[model samples]
Target chain A: MIDIYEIIGLIAATLTTSAFVPQVYKAWKSKNTESLSLTMYLAFFVGIMLWLVYGIHLNSLAMILSNTATGFLALILIILKLKYK
Target chain B: MIDIYEIIGLIAATLTTSAFVPQVYKAWKSKNTESLSLTMYLAFFVGIMLWLVYGIHLNSLAMILSNTATGFLALILIILKLKYK
Candidate 1:
């Protein structure tokens, strides 16, 4: 039986994970990452990486999915910031 | 006994939670959120809220603390975005 709460977790994961799309799109289109803070994203990436580790420890699907997805997005932004500036 | 992994999670939470400070400071200092995506933060806020709920359900201290802390920062950014633009 699928837990409704887990279902909610998945939905939440989807929402948060997809939230990076617009930023990535805009950054890709504009070729500008001046406004995006590199420090924030780097810290975020590290944090997400840790979260992934912790999630794996707990065997949480939601944490795993959300962090993995967003970690990639943050990497993109981080790379963009590096390439652009 | 405090689990070492849980300690890692707390440190990770602190890293991620503190990541927002520079952003809020930057936005507030410049009064420019043109670079910050409102949709991204809005989606993130909602997602974090859900995570908080899920964390509460599972009684996960790290998840609860991290989301609650970051959620406040995200809200600050959201409000700043609205105020600036």
Candidate 2:
């Protein structure tokens, strides 16, 4: 049986990681990322990559799923920042 | 022997999560979050909480450490946004 903590973790990961979606959508739709810093996104992108590697090492599905999705979303912003800026 | 993957994971978590420090510092020093969207930070704050819960669930030291640090940093920015703005 899954414990309450595990359930909470799952819900938390799902919600927070998914939070990037709106920002991603905004960046894409507006085609503007001038306010967003390239340095910040670059650092974040690298950080997410590391998290992915760490997730893979732990063989944890939650880490993998959340980081993967977050990484992708961050990447979208990074790309938009690049493309539009 | 410690595996390469685990080392990578540790490094990744440390670097990426810590990357927020500069932004946090900038926000703290400049006291300017006008460009920052409160919604993004709010969502990120919630997401980090979930990640923390997930980390606690997995009993992963890396997750706990990284998320805790990230959450704290995000919280700082959030507070500054509130206080200064």
Candidate 3:
């Protein structure tokens, strides 16, 4: 039985996960990623991967799904940053 | 009793939370945000705030601390994005 707090966490996860979309879209459309920090994305990618492992450890669907999606998006951003540079 | 998974979670939290700092530093140093997506930061800020509330509800120190730090950093990024634009 999912409680209110769990729902809140899921919402948070969803928002944070999807938040990367616009940046990716902007970067993709503009082909400009000068302002995007490569260091930040590199660290974030590692962090998200760790979070995915943790989610798997806990068998948490929310964490797993969110981190997976976020990781993929973050990767694209990384590649875009490098490519545009 | 904190286990290995808990430690991994903490590391993951720390990495993701701290990841924003580089972006902030880069933007602050560069004073150029032409490529930073305003829409992304706005949504991310709200997501971090929700994560903070969820963390508080769970009474998890890792989540609370990480989210609080991340929320502060995300807010700064948002402000920098708007200000520099």
The TM-score of the first chain in every model comes to 0.94, 0.87, 0.88
Compare candidates 1 and 2 on lDDT and give the better one: 1
True lDDT of residue A16, candidate 2? 68
Please provide, for model 3 over A1-85, each residue's C-alpha lDDT reduced to its tens digit, 9 standing for 90 to 100. Answer: 8888667778888889888788788889999888778988898899899888977886656678888999999999999898889
Docking class of 3: medium
Q: Under CAPRI classification, how is model 1 graded? A: medium
Q: Model 3 Cα displacement at B66 (Å)?
A: 1.5
Give the runs in model 1 whose Cα sits over 4 Å from its true position. Answer: none
- Please report, in order, the local distance difference test score of every candidate based on alpha carbons: 0.87, 0.79, 0.82
Candidate 2 per-residue lDDT, tens place, B29-69, comes to: 89998866778888888878887877777776677888888
| Candidate 3: clashing pairs of residues | none
TM-score of 2: 0.81
Candidate 1 per-residue C-alpha lDDT over B1-42 given as tens digits, one digit per residue, 9 for 90 to 100: 889878878878998888878878888899998978898899
Assign candidate 2 its CAPRI class: medium
Q: For model 3, how does the per-residue alpha-carbon lDDT over B3-80 read when each residue is reduced to its tens digit?
A: 887777788899898887877788889988786778877778788888778767756566677778988888877788
- Candidate ranking (DockQ, best to worst): 1, 3, 2
What is the per-residue lDDT of model 2 for residues A1-85, given as tens digits with 9 covering 90 to 100? 8667656666766876866687788788889887678887788888788888877777766767877888888888888888899
Q: Give the best candidate by lDDT.
A: 1
